[model samples]
Target: MTSTPEPWGPVEPLEPALSVRRVLTLERVLAGEPEVVAGAAQLDRPVRWVHVAEAADVGVMLTGGEMVLTTGVLLAGDENAQAEYIRSLHRAEAAAVVLGLGRAFPTTPDVMRRAAERCGLPMVVLHRPFPFAELTEEVQSRLVRRKFAAVSLSEAVRTALTGLITAGAPLQRLLDEIAHHTGCPVVVTNLAHRVLATAGERPAVDDVLRDWERIARQAGGSEGDGWIRAELGGRGERWGQIMLCGYRGDTAGGRLLADRAAEALVLHRMLGGTSAHTWEEQSAQSLLTDLVSGVVPARQLLPRARAAGLPVNRRTFVPLVVRDGDPAQLERMLRLLGLPGLVAEFAEGAVAVLLSLARDQDADALAAHFATRLRTESGESRTVVAAADPRIVWDDVPTGLREAQHVADAVADSSAALDLPAVVRLRDVHLRGLIRLLRDDPHVQSFAERELDGLLCAGAGDDLLAVLRTYLASGRNKSRTAQLHHVSRPALYRRLEAIEARLGVDLDDFEQAASVHIALLAHDAQQA
Candidate 1:
């Protein structure tokens, strides 16, 4: 599925809390002509607050993320004190330290510089006398504004996503909302890096996923250039991650968007009471449902199928529909058997599955194995897997799916009582299949109505209809029909005679009996 159309103009990317790099650019700090003395590479580190202190143990009164400003007066006389001071700042995770020089020391000190360099704490020196309060006031105000903006953005996104979840919007719609806010492609993946869903500007999203395998392999550790990732899980179990692909916003803001999206997804799953596997099934459901319904052309859906981790290129497609089988269980079984396939439930209660297999693989054997294994696993001997002829072209899958569904429908009734093959093919259903295929034909309907009209009348009340069903399904064997219906032979004979008399037919005549049975099958198939 495609992303929801963008309804508004471009959203300005989020700004992170003031960074030391940003701090250095301020007019107040720039007035002193600041020079980077040490740890110049980490300029982008966030500065939560600005502090001015000359006490060596000033790091004790501080929390992390503070940019400490000092005059170096207390640090100049003692080398150990200077080194300890830098170490303390590093341990406290201070953002950076700026040393202003005048009476404290006319220039940057080698001892303090060496300590800051060793500890990897950003150290800056003022070349001219400058008021520290000016820089502090400017940076703190900016930090407060950025923090406010971040909180407002977070709350806005959370509210939007919550509304979508409450409205019963699916996962794709939620991702679309996230992409709309971030102006970036949103990607959701399982632990193995299988892409389950994606949304964003179509071209940008396609570009991000064009080389997804390589990108996924290289993506590790913390945030990359706009690539913000958040864990998608709850209760101490992380099943996957949600990522903003090529998010060019500030890291903290990208983080906020990713985090809000992740929270919404987790809460959505919890409220919907579905597992990760169920979400995967839903994705498959959307894709397969579209394919079978033919609402969207197959060529347009190729990209989605490929992005969903299905190997679609140059493969054989085996379409199989199982009667009354669980989609989740079928998908798991496919994985256990080391096959690549997509499983989704059809509108008519049958689970439709499409297997992607290599050209040289034995498709029939694997399909049979899947059906047999599913039967064994579910302990359901009556499960019918109606198989359609494998198609080599992707465009032909819709027809194959319809054929599979039709065959499955054909077997839905007789499979339980009759000994149906584990993997029921089109030819296996024979007359039953033809009846189902022709159930909607006007002539077939008229013929069925004409032949079975007596039993279908309002006065019949389904008594003789039930007897006829059992007698016909038992292949005209009266004794077996009597035993199955839990009635004696004389009682079954009387019912059969009543059925024959009401329909103006002879049960002993093979041709008449076969016609009535076919009409009954056609009627039942039509009703189904």
Candidate 2:
């Protein structure tokens, strides 16, 4: 037995066209019995206007996307001229060509029809006598009406978004309004490409964010069906972008919605005195400061961190301290790397960043990468110091931060006189770093004073002290020290002999030289 055929589903309605289509049922033109002789498949091309041109070079007089009304008066016998006329209109991007019949060969010219077919330019012929004035008036009026409707729609969207902003609606509410108007997913992101807010059906939002890294990479060019973004901010200070995902509308309409939403969000943030970006940074800074101070236990601070959108329980934490780098640039870089972290201005001339690492990631490698990026971005004047604890527990983060801070402080103190690596760590600073940490103690201060008292009180300036520092720092190599101080060999020897005599120590003795070196490091640390 044969199965019954299934009933067909209802057809979905077509979206409204931005401009009048060439195949639009023009009642006056159709009453004259027009025949579409070529490019029937392209009859739906948009026509911005209707123009009458009897010249052979009419294409020069027209802009793109217009339907030309002609009578073939100039090319009634010449086939090449007919072909060239059709080719010119095609090059000018004319929507369609309408020819009035009974005066030019009583039918469409074979050369013009073939040319239109080759160029995919729709060609229509009126079989009966038709007035070009009537058709032009009808099409022009329709085009004007459509243009007005589009302007009205844009104004309506702007008013709605403005009202929402004036009412003090939150960011999510504003995004939701945009989504409602566009019937698509709306997203807001900072310059770093972190998703700040989203509004749409849950599944649609998830689909957009599922491959966010790829999407972010492609966001530099907004020429696709996936997403379109409108920049936010003014006066050359671009703070973020508003994106419309899966917007199934004309590009003009989608852009209108995105621009209105972006404007509303910017105004909302300005009126509220704090943006979502600023608030998030402030929250992270507060949490990090509290963690470093050890005023609250790690377990107790977990809830606050989670509320601030930090992933704490299953992540590896690396504490980093950067000297002479901008905190804002660091935050932007972190967002670009898709690494969530807390960044803030710590002490004067120092920025602290607490990086959240995934389970499989290496903290040291990431720290090195971050340091290289910082150097490349901010130049060699900046230094980055990091501490990576093998134990990835939250309880250890406070200690790690202190360690990193100490390393950074020591590196900054010594960077002026010594050439150090870009990425500094605890091992790089060694004994001098340890001594700097204890420089404030009474015993350490006393030792440093006793070891260098003679030089300190010799009525001579820091010249001899400078000589001793270079001498000790160069591993007691006289020639190397002379090269560093830009002095002759005899002058360097005399300076070294004077230093040894005043300090009451033998320069040839390794133990005595080591003691003096330690004393000098302690004094420098205390001074710093």
The TM-score between candidate 2 and the true structure equals 0.53
Q: Candidate 2, clashing residue pairs?
A: none
Candidate maximizing TM-score: 1
lDDT at residue 166 of model 2 (Cα atoms): 66
Model 2 stretches with alpha carbons more than 4 Å out: 1-15, 18-22, 26-35, 40-44, 222-226, 273-276, 279-355, 358-528
lDDT score, residue 491, model 2?
Answer: 90
Q: Count the backbone clashes (under 3 Å) in each candidate.
A: 0, 0
* Reference-based TM-score of each model: 0.73, 0.53
